[model samples]
Target: MKLSGLKSVENAHDDSIWACAWVPATENRPALLLTGSLDESVRLWRADGLEPFLPSPSTGHCLGVVSVAAHPSGAVAASASLDSFVRVFDVDSNATIGTLEAPPSEVWGMQFDPKGAMLAVAGGSSGAVKLWDTSTFELLATLPVTPPNQQDQQPPPRPASKGSTPGGKFALSVAWSADGRRLACGSMDGTIAVFDVARGKLLHQLDGHFMPVRSLVYSPMDSRVLFSASDDAHVHIYDAEGKSLVGAMAGHASWVLSVDASPDGGAVATGSSDRTVKLWDIKMRAAVQTMGTHGDPVWGVAFRPPGGAGVRAGRLASVSDDRSISLYDYS
Candidate 1:
């Protein structure tokens, strides 16, 4: 696979653009790119021009937008901010569908289930994954990612502390498996927790990094494989089920802030404080292409979802602290 720069929108937002997602295409329109920024607003962009599709910006998000996710159906999308609010709104009409908040539990990463039945959010500092039913707009559960090495579970000297507690975990990012049976979350302390969706229990803890893992994406083609980008400036691949470290690829000069896998699952893309976006070949475990288009730290990168009529070409989008967004044609 190869990536060629297609378009760049300088100062796309007034502040750092921290999140991005590709809203699925609909019968009336092709897929569109959605981005949220530290500027406290979310903007939509078509694949062609970097123009804002909506005449006015969607406001109401206090503080800064931390993450964005589009529902599978393409009718709605959601954005989470540091304020702990998950705002769900229509993709086209831009109407507020619903807003969810698990107070005392700040929000981080979020993704809708493949079937669009539930929305799983990474509970910041809550040390758990919060699930919300799409229809009821009610929280289903807060599945905690408890570490197994608890001292209390053992006899005598017990584990020093229940570092496994959700608060101790300080969850940062989350990703669901292709089949939707498993969920994995990354923490600020560099621990990864894998859980069974049905059983709602912690399965394993995968270890490889020493810094905060800010972004994670499970391979769309392989449910067992997972990719993570961390502040340590490395991208680590893991076998989520086996809890084994598959590989670690490092090149960025600064923190790797965000990562996403291609729909075909052959490659992965990452944004970093190094102010560059790097495309890595998963099988070869190496960086094949590097694009230095942003002068500031890149915060988010998203590959367009594979769908939409007559849309055969591939696209990758990245947003940076330079307050700009860049698009690439991937082939």
Candidate 2:
């Protein structure tokens, strides 16, 4: 499938469009595109023309929105902001369902369980993945990250000349396995920590990128493969279960802010601070098409989830620093 730019809404947001997701269709409406911006608003757009459907702006997020995720059931979606608040809201009614918070820690990326039973938030600077029971909005667990391969004994402290500190860990992005049995989170230091959700134990770390990983997503069809986008301007495909870097796709001239795989698992779309949206052929491990459709840095790009009511053609949505949102036809 190729992408043809359909529409661009300039100044759709006030500041930066940081995150976007597709809200699967309900019985009365087609699938809609949900976008969150640094302006602290979460918006819903009609899928057909990318027009604003519900102007009931979700407010009260004190900081920039960092990530947005829609539950598989089409009833709820969650958003995480720099203020470290995870707001779970109803999709159709535009009502706040729940608000989750963890003190002394900022929030970044987030995802809902495949079965919509839980919400996972990447706890920034907290070195943990926070899970909430969806029904009760109760704190389920905090999965702490373990340092990779350090000897049992603690290492010596660094010299005064060095600026870095010891024992500081920051988590930035998170993904859940399709079966909801496994969870993986990426950190500011470029480490992907895997965990067994059932046991709440650390599994292993997937290492490749040396820069902050901004986004992570698991292929719905193959839970073993994970895609990561980093500030290094490359998308790395990792064997999540095998803990090996399958390959890296690079082309963006600046930080790759967001990366998402097509539901069919054949293509991936990435938004970059370089002011462009790119479509990558996963099998070729290269960018096959580039669309400079946004006037400013593109921060978020998302593929519409499949199997929703009345959903047919593939759809892609992108939000930018230019305060605009762009829609593309992927067919």
Candidate 3:
């Protein structure tokens, strides 16, 4: 797979663009892109011409938007702020549907289940993953973080020790299994925990990264495969169910902030503080293509989902601290 520059929107956001997701195409429209920024706003954009949709989506977020998750139906999506406000809004109308708030538990990463029936949020410093019913927009449960191998109920070693720390790491990123039976969250301390969604139990921890893991994605084709990007400047691929780190790829000189796997599951893309975007072939466990030399750190990267009528060409997007968004063609 290769990535070719398609378009770059300079100053895409007034502040840094920290999160992004692709809203699936509907009958009257092609797929649209959603971006959240530290500017306290979330904007919608059309891939064609890389132009912004008129009317400036929404601007009520208090602090800054940190995470965004799109519902499976493409009718609605949610955005979370540092102030712990999760806003679920209409995609086309920009009308607020539901607002979820829970104090004492800050939001970090969030993702909707495969069926869009549930939403899972990584709670920062709260030591639990918060689940909300999407339809009702009500808090359902808080699953505590506990390492599967906690001897005598003691937490693992501190981070920075090459992941000797077992559990209770600060949750930084979250990803749901393709089947929606399992959920995985990466922590600031570089530990990734897999949880049994059905049983509401801690499954295990996958160890490898020694720094904060900011982004994670499960392969669309395989529920067992997970890809992670971390401050360690490396991307690790793991079998979340097997509880083993199967592959590691390193190329960035600085922290890797975001990672997303291709729809085909043949490759994974990463954005790094080194101001670069890279594509790594999963089977080879090596970076085959590199793009970007932005002036500041790349904060987020996302692959367009494989749906929507006539959406054949592959697309990739990256947002950076430089306040720019870059689009690429992956084929």
lDDT of each: 0.86, 0.82, 0.84
Worst 10 residues of 1 by lDDT: 156-165
Ranking by lDDT: 1, 3, 2
| Candidate 1, superposed: residue stretches over 4 Å from native | 148-167
Each candidate's number of clashing pairs is 3, 0, 2
Q: Write the per-residue lDDT of candidate 2 for residues 68-163, one digit (tens) a residue.
A: 999887778888876768889988888898888865455777888889888888876667788889999998998876554542342332211001
- Candidate 2: lDDT of 238? 91
TM-score of each: 0.93, 0.92, 0.93
Q: Which 10 consecutive residues of model 2 have the lowest summed lDDT?
A: 157-166
Which has the greatest lDDT?
Answer: 1
Question: Which candidate, 2 or 3, has the higher TM-score?
Answer: 3
After TM-score superposition, the amount by which residue 134's alpha carbon in candidate 2 deviates from its true location, in angstroms, is 0.2
How does residue 217 of candidate 1 score in lDDT?
A: 90
Model 3's lDDT to the true fold?
0.84
How much lDDT does candidate 1 score? Answer: 0.86
lDDT digits (tens) for residues 1-331 of candidate 3: 8998999999888998888998887887888889999999999889656799757758968888888888888888999887779999999999999998866445878999999999999887666789999889888888866554553464543322212223446677899988999999888778888999989888888889987888899999999999999899999989899989998899999899899999999999998889899999999999998896567888889999887777889999888889888899999
